[model samples]
Target: MLLKFSRNGRTTKALSCLLSEGFKRNARPQQAANLLRPSYLLFSPDISFLRRPSLLVKRVVCWLSVNYQISSNSWSDPMDTNEASSCLVEQLAVDPERQSSSPACPNDGDEKESVFKGLGILDRFLAVWIFLAMAIGIILANFVPNAGPALQEGTFVRVSVPIAVGLLLMMYPVLCKVQYETLHRLLRTRRLWIQIAFSILLNWIISPFFMLALAWAFLPDEPELRQGLILVGIARCIAMVLIWTGLADGDGDYCAILVAVNSLLQMVLFAPLGVFFIQVISGDSVSFEYAMAAKSVAVFLGIPLGAAILTRFTVRGLASERWYDQVFLKWIGPWSLIGLLFTILVLFASQGRQVVHQIVSVVRVAAPLIVYFIIIFFATLFICYRLGFGYKLATTQSFTAASNNFELAIAAAIATFGANSDQALAATVGPLIEVPALLGLVYAVKLVAKRLGWKD
Candidate 1:
C-alpha cells in the first residue's frame, strides 16, 4: 500500500519525498494567525531560555546587572583556566594557520568549545560556495530545462516547496545558538538602551532610506529590481547577524538584544515600511496584503524561533545548559551551514535561467549592494565612535545594521509577488553579494581591533 498525505488540498505520496524534492502550501494570514495563536508570543527571542533560573540564579542575575557595563572592558574579563582551555581546544578544531596562532591555556580533557567555535570552514568560504552554487544552478537550468520548472509546481503562498524547506533548515540552528536567557540581564544596562536606540536609528531610519536611494539611483528602468532592494532594507537581519556579530568578536549579549528587538519589530513594521517605501520610490501604486507578509514572517521566522526555544528548554532540562550550548548545539549548529548551502543551491537552481539571461542586470543590481555594505559599515562605525562605544559593541552595531535578512526578504517577495518575479530575483541576489563582502569586513574588523588593542 502507498502511503500519502494531504496538505493545502493536495495529496503527496510521502512527506519525506516532498521534503527532499519540495512542497508548497498556500498558508494565508488568518490561517497563520490561527496556527500561531497559542505560541505567537514565542516568536519573540526574549521568551525562552535554555534553563530556568533557580534561587541561586536570582543572585547571579542581580550580581551581573550591578557589575555589568556595556563597555568591552566590563565584560571582557581575563579567561579562567577552564575557559582558556576550552578556547584552546576550540582553536585546535580549525585550520592549522589558526591553530598556530592559538593562545596558551590549560588542557582540560572536558573543555567546552568557545561560543564562536561555530564559525568553521563552511562559513569562512561561504562566498566561494555561493558563487559555485550559482554556476551549477545556471548549468542545470540550461541542460535540464525542466529542473527549474519542476520545482515551481504545487506552489503555496508563492514560495516554492524546495525554497520553503531550505529556509527552515537554514534558520532553526541559528536560533538554537542564541542565548536568550542572557537577554534579561542585558535589558538592565543603560548601555543596552543606547545600543538599542542606535540600532533602531540605523536599521529603521537610515538603512531603509539608504537602500531606497541606491536602488532608485541605480535601477531607474527596473522597478522590480528597485522594489526588491527596498523590501530587503525594510527587513533587518534576525538570524545570521548572529554569525557575523560573533565572528567579528562582538558582544554576543548585546547582539542578542538587537536581534530580539528586530525580530519583534519585523512583525509589526516590515509590511508597512515595505509598502510605504516601494510606493514612494516607484511612484506607482503598489498593492500588498499585510496578511501575506505576516504569513511569511510567521512561517519562516516564527516557526524556527519557536522550535529553537523548545529545543533549548528540552535539551537543557535533560542535560545542563553547558552541554546544550557547547556539545549538542555545537553539533547541531553546522546544520545551519548545511541548510544554507543547500538553500543556496535550490535558490539559484530555481532562478538560474533568469539570472543567466539577466547577467548584466544582476551585476548592476549587485553594484549598489556592494556600495550599500561599505557605506553602512563605516557610517555605523562613525556613529558608534561618536557615541563613545568601544570596539566590540561598535562592530556589532556596524554588522547588525549592515546585514539584511535576505531570507525574510526573499520569502516576502515570493509571497507578495511570485517566485519567478523580478522581486524574488533581486532578493536572491542579496546573499550572493553579501557572503564574500561581509566575510571581508569580518577580517577588517579583526585587524582594526588588533591595531587598536581592543581585546575581545
Candidate 2:
C-alpha cells in the first residue's frame, strides 16, 4: 500500500516509500525509525522527533533521498527483501564526498572543521609569510640601501604611499566581510553595550596603565622607548585588530563595531591619554599632535571603511546575495593577506636598518610589549569567556583589547618627535613585535577554544 506523509504542506515521497517498504517486510516500527534517527538529529529543527521518534521518522528521512532521485526499479517487488533494505540504506546514507562538494547543504563535520580550513595557503601560514616579508624588507634595506629611501619618498597625508596602499588593500576586504545588515539588531541588543563597556574599561582604563607599568619596569633608563610604549598603549587598535579577529574566527560584525567605537574614542582621547601616560605619569616631556592621531584614524580607517561600504552595498545591490557572498567575497578575500604581507615588507623595509642595528633597543622594547600582549589577551579572553560571550565575541574582545594602533602611534611619534628620533624607532618596533605576538595569540585562542568546548 502506498502511503503519503507531509511536513509543512509538502509531501515526502522517499519517506513514504521507506515506511511502506518496512511495513511490507513486517519490520518493527522501532527498527524502521532507528535508521533515520541520526539524520533527524543532525538536520531536523523539530523537537517532536524526540518524543515521537517513530511517528516523525518518515518526515525526517525525506531530506536524505531528496537530493538524489530514487528510481522506481529500486523499489520494485522483483527485488528480494535483503536487496530492498540494502537499496534503501544506500540511498539514505549521507555521502561525505557529496556533502563536502555541495556548499548548499553543510553537515556536522563541516561545522567541526578548523575555522582556518577555508583560508588559502597564504592565510594559513600567515606568520611564516610575515617573517619572510620582514626578512626580505630587511635585506633590501641593508643591501640595496636606496630602496628604503625610494619606497619612503612619497607620502599621502604623512603616511608612506606604499604603506598606505597596503593598509587600504588589507583593510578593505576585511571590512567588506562585516555583516552590515545585522548591525542595527546588534546595536539594539544590551549585550553589545555591555561588551562595549567592557572594551572601554580594558582598552582605555586597564591596558594603558598596564603597558605604562611594563614599560617602566622593563625600560627604566630608556625614556624614549618608554614614551613610545606608552603612546602605543594609549592609541588603541583600529586597523589590524580586524585582521587578527578574522584570523581567529571571531565575529567580524562585532569586531567592526568595536573598531568603529575605538576609532571614534581614539580621536577624542588618544592625545590626552598619550600626554597623561607619557608626560604626567612617566615624567617625560613630549608633544603629541591631536591632529596627527585624528588624521591617522581618518586615513587608515575612514578610507577603507568607506570603500568597503560602497563595494559591499554596490555589489550586493547589483547582484544577488548568494552571488555577492559566494563569488565577489571569494575573489576579494585573498587580497587581505596579500596586503598584509605587502604592508609588512614596506613597513620593515623603512625601518630595517634600525631593527637590525638597534637589536638591543628592539629587545628592550619587545620584552615589555610581549609581556603586555600576552597578559592582556588572555585576561580579556578569560573574562569574556566567563561572562558567556562565546568563542567568537570573546576572541574579538581579546584581540581588540590586546592590540594597539601601531600606525597611529608611529605617525604621532614621528610627527611629534621627528622621523629619526628614538621615539619613532620605538613606535616602529611596535608592529615588529606585534605582528608575531598576535599571530601566536590567534593559534592559542583556537587551541583554548577547542579545549574549553567552545563551539562555533
Candidate 3:
C-alpha cells in the first residue's frame, strides 16, 4: 500500500491526497498537520539516494506506511481498509523529518545534578561527619586497644598506612580538578601574581611568625607541644585548602597556582622554617632534617599531584575533555571526602587514649591554632579586598593562606620526635579544630559575598 511517486511527476499529487486524508481523520486538521511541518524538516540528500531514486523513495514509503499504521492503531474511529491504505500511501509522499527527537548535546545541569546527588547527606554535613569520626576513633582506641597497634603496624615515619592512603585519596581528586591550561593562562594575568604575592607574604612571612607567637603564648611550659604547633604553622597547606577554597566558591585556577607554588616552596623552606620557628618558640635548638622535609613533600604532595596530572592527561587524550570533566571527575570528587573521613578516624583511633589523657594540653595547643585560622582568614580577606580582588579570588587567597598542611606536619613530627611524643599529639589536634573552624569561615565568606553583591 506504500506509495512510490516518480521524481518526474505525481509527488505533489500524492502529498495532497495525504493531507486530505489527515484532514478527514483529525478533529483539527491544522493541529494534526503541525506534526509533519515541512519547514522544520532537516534533510541531507545523498548522491547514492539520488542515483537509486526509486529504491530510496520506495523504502521511505514503506517505513512511513508502517509508522502511520502503528501511530493510528489505538484510535477508536473506524475507517475502510482500502481508504486507510490509500491514506498511508499518500502520507508516504510527504518529506521525512530527518532530525532526531532527542537532544544532540548533554547539559551541564545534568552533570552537576548527578555529582551532587551522588554525594548524599554525608557530604552536605561534612563537619558533623568528621566530629562523629573522631568519637568513633576514640571509642575504638579505648576499648579495642589491639586494633590501633595493628592498624598502625604498616607505619612509615610514624604515618600509618591507612592515614597515608587516605591523604593521597583526599588530595588526588582536588588536584585532578585543577586545569593546567588555566594555570598557564593565569601566569600571564596580573591577579595571579597579586594572589601569589599575597599567599607568600602570609604563608612564609606573616603566618609563620604569628603561629610561633601563638604557640609561645598558649603552650609556653609545654616545649614539645609548642615545637609541634610551630611545625604545623611552617608547613603551609597545598592540598586540603583546595577543598575549603571550593566550599567558599573561590577561584580554583588561582588556588591551584598558589598550591603548586607552596608545594615547591615547602621543599626548599620547610626545614629552615621549622628549625627557625621551633628554636624561637621553644628556646631550644630543634633538629629538622632537609631530607625529612623533602620526603614529606614528595610523598604528600608530589605523588598525588603526579598521579592527578597523569590521570587527567590520559583521560582527556582518550576521551573528550567534556566527558572527563563532567563525568569522570564528577565521580572521582567524592574520594576526597572519603579519604578525609578515614584519615580522621585512624588519627583519633591511634591517638584516642593519649588524646583523652592529655585532653587539657590538646585544648591549650588548639586554642592558638583556632585563633590562627580565624586571624589569618580575616587578615587575608581584608588584604584581598584592599587589593580590589573580587570575592572569588579573595576567598581563594583566604583559604590558601589560612589552612595548614597538617599531613606534612604530622609526618614531620612523627619522624623527628617519637610517635608517642607530645609533638605528634599536638599535630593530631590540628584538624580537629581546623576542620570545623574552616567550615564556619566558608559560610562566612558566602554571606559576606552576598552582602557585598560580589560575583562568585
Highest lDDT model number: 2
Tens digits of per-residue lDDT, candidate 3, 1-456, equal 222233433333333333443443333334344444332111222224456566456545544553464356433443334543444333333333311111211122222222123234756788788889999999999999897888889975457889888889999998899887566677888866876887899889999889988988888788889888988898899888998887666878788888889999999999987776677545688688798778778888888989998999999999978679767887888889889899889988988888899989888988998899999999889877877888888898889889998888888888889789999899888888888899888878776765666664
Ranking by TM-score: 2, 3, 1
Model 2, residue 318: C-alpha shift (Å): 1.4
Total backbone clashes of candidate 3, pairs 3 or more residues apart or in separate chains? 0
Runs in model 1 with CA error above 4 Å?
1-119, 154-157
Each prediction's Cα RMSD? 19.2, 10.7, 14.9
Question: After superposing candidate 3, which stretches have Cα over 4 Å from the reference?
Answer: 1-120
Better of 1 and 3 by TM-score: 3
Pairs that collide in candidate 2 are: none
Query: Which candidate number has the best TM-score?
Result: 2
lDDT values for all models: 0.68, 0.78, 0.74
Better of 1 and 2 by TM-score: 2
Question: Which one wins by lDDT: 1 or 3?
Answer: 3
Q: How many residue pairs clash in each candidate?
A: 1, 0, 0
**What is candidate 1's TM-score against the reference?**
0.71
TM-scores, all models, native as reference: 0.71, 0.78, 0.73
lDDT at residue 422 of model 3 (Cα atoms)? 93
Put down candidate 2 lDDT per residue, 122-234, tens digits, no spaces. 78888899999999999988888898889879988787899899988989999999978779998999989998998899989999999989988999998988888888999
